[model samples]
Target: MVVTMLRLRKAVTNLTQPQFIEGYRKAQLIDVREPKDFEAGHILGARNIPYSQFRQRFKEIRPDKPVYLYDQNGGKSARAALFLRKKGYGQLFHLQGGFRLWTGKVKSK
Candidate 1:
C-alpha cells in the first residue's frame, strides 16, 4: 500500500475593474504595458514592468504578496500571469480589460 499527495496549482483570475480597484491599495499593481504607455498614464502606485522585460525583471516582483497586473488589453497580463505562476507565484490577479479600458485614477509622467 502506498499513499501520495497531489497538489494542484491555481490559475490567475480576471478581476473586473471594480473588484480590481477595491483591492488596489493592498495589492502590488504591475503595469505590463510598454514604458511609453506606462509613462503616458497608469494606475497610481503601479510599477511599470513591461511584458517585454518580464522575464529578465521578474526578480523585481515579490512572490509572497498579492500581485495585480494589467496591460494594453489583458493579453500581456494574462501571459505574465502564466509566467509568474510557473515561477511559483500563488496569489495573482489581473484586470479584466487592461489599461485601455481602465477608468480609475491614473498618474502621468
Candidate 2:
C-alpha cells in the first residue's frame, strides 16, 4: 500500500465522476465540507465528515476502500486528502474541481 505522502496532479488522478458515482455504492464517498455547506447541497450519498472533524474521526473511515472527498472549491477536499495521507489512508481521492464541477444527474436532497 502507499505508505508515504504522494502528491498527485488532479489530471493524473484515475477518478472520474461516473467512476466515483458507481463506486459510491461500494466505497466511501465523503464530503469534507462544513456542516452548513453540506446542508446547502452535496453529492448524493456523500457522508459529511467536515475537514475540522476528520482527524478525530479518522477511525470511522474504512481503510480497505477508496475514499472520495469534495468541497465547494476543491481546496478543502485537497486538504482532506493530505490529512488522510498523513493519517495512513492509502486509498484517497479528491473530486477534480470538486462539487462545483459535478454535472451528473445525482442531486442532494
Best of the candidates, lDDT: 1
Model 2 C-alpha lDDT per residue in residues 17-102, reported as the tens digit of each score: 77767666677888888888888888878889998897798778887787877887777777777777767778777677778878
lDDT against the true structure, each candidate: 0.87, 0.73
Tell me which residue pairs clash in candidate 2: none
User: Model 2, clash count?
Assistant: 0
Query: Which segments of candidate 2 are over 4 A away from where they belong?
Result: 1-14, 105-109
In model 1, how large is the Cα lDDT of residue 63? 96
Every model's TM-score: 0.89, 0.78
Candidate 1 structure quality by residue, lDDT tens digits, 14-107? 8899999998779889999999999999999999999999999998999999999999898788889888988999899989888888889999
Candidate 2 versus truth, CA RMSD in Å, comes to 4.5
